[model samples]
Target: MTDALNDDRKGWMSLLAKAPPARLAALMPDLPDHALLRAPEVGAVMVRGRTGATGAPFNLGEMTVTRCSVRLAEGAVGHAWVQGRDKAHALRAAVVDALMQTPESAGLHACVLAPLAAEAELARAVRAGKAAATKVDFFTMVRGEDA
Candidate 1:
């Protein structure tokens, strides 16, 4: 794939993975002609984390994930792995992924990804506001002897 296509795919995948199931359902477009290359399946994967963002990676724990794969009639294949056991969400995401690789991608990006990205940004802002409300500041007092 070209760099531009890869970048677009990455952006859409991030939005899809973070989007709530209800939100995705509300914006779902008409399904394209496709075949389920791999039916949605729920499984566990080892969640890994890196220390201080640059240290050695370590297994955080096992997380439940649902994954699905689909192949469009035009031969584009798409895959999705989402957190939780929502098979429907995984299937929809995979279908969208496949569609994004086709000529209809521009429409999908505008109708689906744009809205989802906006919603995700709004949700993040709300969370940040809540966190900021409770933020505490620390200071040190100088002793008289220090004069």
Candidate 2:
């Protein structure tokens, strides 16, 4: 289990934290047919800002966030998310949500969530690499008078 955690660069909670609802739904399998799990609803987007590694402050833009809470017939609750207009992601998030409150979360995190987190990290890394390639540096020199 720890191996899986180390292998995945992105945290499992992070993968679920700002995911697209549709993608999440697609990834997450449905609970037992006899047992129904509630799906999460698309809620308000929360915005936050922070300084980059260089200590320059910037607005990080908004994330479309949805929250879902569900109770399995067996009484387990799971919740999850994706990014942007995504019902599938929301559904899957709810499944994860329901599983989280149970002892089964360890197994679920290892099997289901870890892979998703790893994939997300890979995608993020690719995007970061691409963005980094385009970074521009500007330099200015000050002129000095006679000493």
Candidate 3:
């Protein structure tokens, strides 16, 4: 796949994985039947983190994850890895992932992906706002021997 296409797919996949299960289900449309290449399976993955966003990575801890793979009737294959052991969520996410590559993607983007992105952005903004409210400005006063 081209870089642009791959990046676009990556964006939606991340969004779907992080989306709330019940909310994603509610916004989901009538998905076409698909063949499950891999049934939903739960597993644990080691979480990694970097200090100061540039330091060497360190193992944070283990996290529960669920993954599923599906092939759409139209030939597109999709896979999903989501946090937690929500089998249904993984299945639905995989289905969406497959469908997003087809011609019907425009409608799905408008109806499902758009709202999810909006909600995610709004929630992020709210969290940022809360954090900003408590921010401490450490501006050094002009008390040095410069005056």
Global lDDT of each candidate: 0.89, 0.62, 0.94
Tens-digit lDDT track of model 1 for 1-147 = 899968878888878877898889889945777799999999999989999979999999999999999999899998899999999899889999998888889988899999899888999999999999999897768868896
What TM-score, over all chains together, does every model reach? 0.87, 0.57, 0.88
lDDT of 3 by residue, 1-147 (tens): 999999999999999999999999999956688999999999999999998779999999999999999999889999999999999999999999999999989988998899999999999999999999999989877867877
Against the true structure, candidate 1 reaches a TM-score of 0.87
Q: Sum up the clashes in candidate 3.
A: 0
Query: Model 2 lDDT vs. the true structure?
Result: 0.62
Q: Which candidate model has the greater lDDT, 2 or 3?
A: 3
Question: Can you tell me which runs of candidate 3 are displaced by over 4 Å?
Answer: 51-53, 137-147
Best by TM-score: 3
Candidates by TM-score, descending order: 3, 1, 2
The C-alpha stretches of model 1 lying farther than 4 A from their native spots are 51-53, 137-147
lDDT of 2 by residue, 46-101 (tens): 56555765676576777776655556777765555555656656556666666665
